[model samples]
Target: LGNVRGKDWRIQTNVYGNGSTTRGREERYLVPFDPTEEPHRYSILWTPDYIIFYIDDVPIREVVRSDAMGGDFPSKPMSVYATIWDGSSWATSYGRIKINYKYAPYVSEFSDLVLRGCRVGPIQQVDSADRCAEAVEELMSADYALLTPRKRAAMRRFRERYTIYSFCYDQHRYGNVTFPDCDYVSSEHSRFGEWGDNKFPPKEVRRARRRSRKPSAVDDQPSK
Candidate 1:
């Protein structure tokens, strides 16, 4: 349930089991990234329908919300997170690359962060109900939240060249059952019951993959 800056220097869109799930789900989407080179601006845009992950403002990954997800979807209020540490025991390609102590005191910089989330005061329980106020709705509906042709192309190219790991194609891991948003996503990006092997003909052939086709329902129920 976190993005780890592995020794490979690749930014992976990885998520383990959500807090509500029993067996921790293991999945990751690899993208072209190198944090050691220079400062790169990473951004996250979360809407009711999906959460978009961007590197230097170019969209690279999307986590779509769906009815099939049940409690596994990250529906409750969450906070922004960042970390810099020595996860050498288990971070890089499953601990293949151990952190060298010679490069001690690892430093991670943060700047120009943009966060927009609703505040519903205190919640007494996990099952409390919630809704976005008009002001919050306006914020989430801003143009930055929508998709464009160029961004879609960037996402497709990134996925085509870089998405090395995906849960949708890991049939053996999930017992061959597609989880959550795969019905609409991997089936289009990947081969039939296989890993993502499709090539994009033209940018136009690639549909706006992340835009929520229908406006998300505002009435939300709370969970971890």
Candidate 2:
């Protein structure tokens, strides 16, 4: 359910509980750019039927609900939260690393906030059925909600180039059961190892790994 970050920082998205019939999935990718150098936009679009995750207007991943999915899709309403804490003890590096207080008081910033959805009170009688339908229609009609051919192609390219782990192709872990919602692509599947790690990392990622590794004493001896 969690992972340790390698020397190269990568971004990951997860929806838990699907494996044990509780509805969960995960995807990971090496970030295209240095996030610390500048601020970038990240957004999530969730509807009754599908969910999309975006980075600066580019749709990176989409999940569509299906009958086979059952309760795995997130159906309930939830609030948005921006957390700035490290989960090193458990989630990151499996407790090998701890948060260093030298970098205390981290800051997270947000801007241009926009939330669009039908608001329903705890009591269902507070909102009319007709009003809720109207809201749903409007949200579905928005440009961002519609992933056209171009957007789909872009998404495919991003996944091919950056995706390092995806539960959909992790046959080793799932034991031959592909998640119902996954849109299987043979070409993309070929890039991943049986265990879900990238089989052939891009040149840049390889270079980064080489740089991060320490030189062993044996390698320091000159060849005769």
Please report the candidate that would top lDDT against the real structure.
Answer: 2
Q: Which candidate leads the pack in TM-score?
A: 2
lDDT at 129, model 2: 57
lDDT for 149 in candidate 2 is: 79
Prediction-by-prediction clash tally: 1, 6
CA lDDT, candidate 2, residue 216: 19
Candidate 1, residue 154: the lDDT equals: 62
Writing each residue's lDDT as its tens digit, candidate 1 over 79-159 gives: 568787666564454577666667667777877776676654555224333456554577668765666675666666555
Give lDDT for model 1: 0.52
Per-residue lDDT of 12 in model 2: 78
Residue pairs clashing in model 1 are 1-16
For residues 1-224, write the lDDT of model 2, one tens digit per residue.
Answer: 22233345567787643235443487887654545445667888888789899877777899998998777887665567777667777433336767666766766678888888888665553456587787888989999999887777767666776687888877777878978888888887788878777788655643533444211111222334
